[model samples]
Target: MNAPQVSPIGGLPSRGFAEPHQNKQQAAPKNDALVQIRCSKAAAKEVKRAAVEAEMTISEFMLVCFHAYMKR
Candidate 1:
């Protein structure tokens, strides 16, 4: 006979934990239009300054911020 498995957290069965997060994900809809954003002169300048501080290019800095902002 097989011994019952033990949990690492909350002592709950492992199978019970996985599905809760999966169920909360939103379904994607059709026809999603991306917003076109124009960076203002001040914002552009800020990105340039940040890039200089990080020893990177303005485009690279903007890419980093774009990814972080999209994630949020």
Candidate 2:
């Protein structure tokens, strides 16, 4: 038996993301406040729910959540 095949989405570049922590010399704001990270589907749903319950923007809720993590 042959393995199943998957087709690519049209006209997209390959390997869209780069290695992290490799471009410290790049231009960026000193107080940049946003970051992006990959999360599992379940984790993403939970974050959204928590943010809504806290009546916070996603960024604010994430900052609060992360601070709570660091405090532990």
Candidates' C-alpha lDDT: 0.73, 0.75
Top model number, TM-score = 1
lDDT (tens digit, per residue) of candidate 2 on 1-72: 999876777755776677667466575548766755667999989978877887997678768878866676
Model 1 residue 13 CA deviation in Å = 40
Q: Tell me the tens digit of each residue's lDDT in model 1 across 1-72.
A: 999987567675555444546435555456688745677999879877878888987678768877967886
RMSD of each: 8.3, 16.0
Worst 10 residues of 2 by lDDT: 20-29
Question: 71, model 1: CA deviation in Å?
Answer: 3.3
Query: How many clashes (backbone N, Cα, C below 3 Å) per candidate?
Result: 0, 0
Off by over 4 Å in 2: 1-35, 65-72
lDDT of 1 at 48: 72
Cα RMSD, model 2: 16.0
